[model samples]
Target: MSILIFSLILLVGAYAAGLLGSLTGLGGGVVVIPLLTLVFHVDIRYAIGAALLASIANSSGAATAYIKEGITNVRLGMFLEIATTAGAVGGALIAVFTPVNTIAILFGLVLIFSALMTIRKKNEHAEQTGSKWSYVLKLNSTYPTANGEVAYKLKNIGGGFSIMLLAGVLSGLLGIGSGALKVLAMDGAMRIPFKVSTTTSNFMIGVTAAASAVVYLQRGYIDPGIAFPVVLGVLGGAFTGARLLTIMNPRTLRIIFCIAISFVALEMIYNGFNHQF
Candidate 1:
């Protein structure tokens, strides 16, 4: 009975994650990690490990559909993978050695930062003016929008890549999706439009997750019992969220997401400082 109940919980969590992730572009980790740790009382490290696996699942599951819809640019995603994968490896290595409290504090800070970034208005007409790498990589692309297909030129490709590397590292280290940072890099630094930036980021996240997931698995941080339910729930939720994306008011959603992240961040900080297990 206990096992069955736990499994049910996990499935529900995963579905919720999927729904919320698709809507907010935040991904499963945003929802799964906290629930695992706070509600289930799982260790943060193991929770992160499970989150990494679920992230891969969510990304792979969604990418094909997004690509078919022409929202994901395979070329752009592949190009960015180089930086993100390298960062994931580095971050995972660091995670093995870092103290749990320190990790918690950093995670809290990152959540707060993500919330701030999400609330800001996008700067349209931002100049894609300079950068040698931007030209060589042809980071520019167009995507279908409600307004019609729109073209965007690349700007500061190197800067965006640099940020992705950092995002990947954090993804591995914290076991969170890291989509917020990825979106910021592509949207803010590269000046890609919101939709394009999001799909592309989603497309690239699986590679980042894969880079560290191997290590986590080998370290036995992965608990299949935990991962199975979370993934299932998150995936279901994400699919629903994606369907609603067209009709939903994103600003209202962003505000709610920000509030949730802020609360989790504070909890993490408190736990870290208090040395609470």
Candidate 2:
């Protein structure tokens, strides 16, 4: 294919990836990497590098706006960052030596699990009253609502932090923001409010991605030619998706998102077994 045609095709794919990501709160990296490696035939390492860069762009862009809205727990996010950053660096280093097929298999499994989790119904309104760890760490906070500010309590700090470390490692290894895992840690283990957990996860992922991105850059994995268009396309698409969030039915969007992710997961698993990288 001609260079122009390839660039255009990538631009369109990246935009769709970003749109789905923003709407689902999944981040764009998952879609971006698969499209790059599976469809475009880019090397997995280069696809990872591009996905990492795009993830930073997507998360940081949304995070800035979210911070202004005061939904993010900056203190809690920073506290978790210590573990995530360390894990990301470790995972990135490991990725350099890991076999391509192994990475593909792991990526496929993670996607399948994430899709299954996404489709499972869950209550988002439940909140803890208090916890010893929350008290020590001052994890409790309030957010502004239409009615009034609503306060929330935290629990299971140790478990949350441990899960965050694992999330960080996966993020670095797969070149994704791993927002799903972060949300699971905060909402499932820490008992944080769902909205707060989502915003905080977005706030923290950019920094985690940057840490591993440095490692990928030093390893000569990031290609500017592939990354530039991806950054622009995903960023624009995410912005558009965010705007559409208010107008669209989230439940409908979520159902569509789950179906899309399931398809990608199955394809990735099939490709992994076929040793297609």
Candidate 3:
């Protein structure tokens, strides 16, 4: 394809990726990387770099809206970010020496896990009074609602912090925000409300992505052509998705997202084993 044609096609694809990501709770980077490497024939490293840029763009855009809504737990997000930021830098540095095929396989596996996590039914946990750590760290906070602000408790701080570290490593390695795992850490481990978990995850994603992005830049993996189209398209699509979410059936969208992501993830794993990369 000519440069103009390639750029246009990528822009469209990235937009679709972003829309689906927004609707399904997967970050745009998950879809963006596969499209670039598998369909567009971009190198894995370059695709990762572009995906990281897309992730940062999407995170920043969504976070602004979430923060404005007063649902984001800024103190909790920032404190947990310390773990993710450290892990992201470590993962990014490790990516430099990792084989391309290995990276592709690992990414595919993580995608499969993410897909499964999305489609599964959620179990509600009763609010905990909170562990001593939550009191000491002051991570507990309230969110706005029609009635008014209602306070929430935090729990299992040690476990949640440990999980955040792994989430950060995956974010750096896969060039994604790892939003799902971050939510898992907060909602599942820390016993935070779902709204708080999601908003805080979005709040933290940009910082995690930025940490890894610095390493990717040092490695010279970033391409201006790919990054520009991916970032612009994802931001545009994310905007449209926010509107669609108000009207769409979230469960249906999640199922569709899970299926689509699984298919691409399997392809990535297949190609990796076949030495296509």
Candidate 2 regions with alpha-carbon error over 4 angstroms: 126-128
Locate the minimum summed-lDDT window of 10 residues in model 3: 119-128
After superposition on all CA atoms, what RMSD does each candidate show versus the true structure? 2.0, 1.4, 1.3
User: What is the TM-score of each predicted model, taking all chains together?
Assistant: 0.91, 0.95, 0.96
Per-candidate clashes come to: 11, 0, 0
Output candidate 3 Cα RMSD.
1.3
Give lDDT tens digits, candidate 1, residues 213-269: 888889898888887787777777877787787776787877898788689879988
lDDT of 1 at 88: 90
Q: Per-model C-alpha lDDT, please?
A: 0.80, 0.86, 0.88
In the range 42-92, model 3's lDDT, one tens digit per residue, is: 999999999889888888888878888899989999899999999999899
Error of 1 at 85 (Å): 0.3
lDDT for position 148 in model 3? 82
- Please write out the lDDT profile of model 2 over residues 1-277, one tens digit for every residue: 8878888889999999899877776678878888898889999889999999988998888887888889999989999998889889989989978888788888877876676656665536646577887888887889777767888888889999999999989988988888888888988998877778889989998999999999999989899889887988898889889999878868777778878887877787788789888
Give the number of the best model, judged by lDDT: 3
Ranking by TM-score: 3, 2, 1
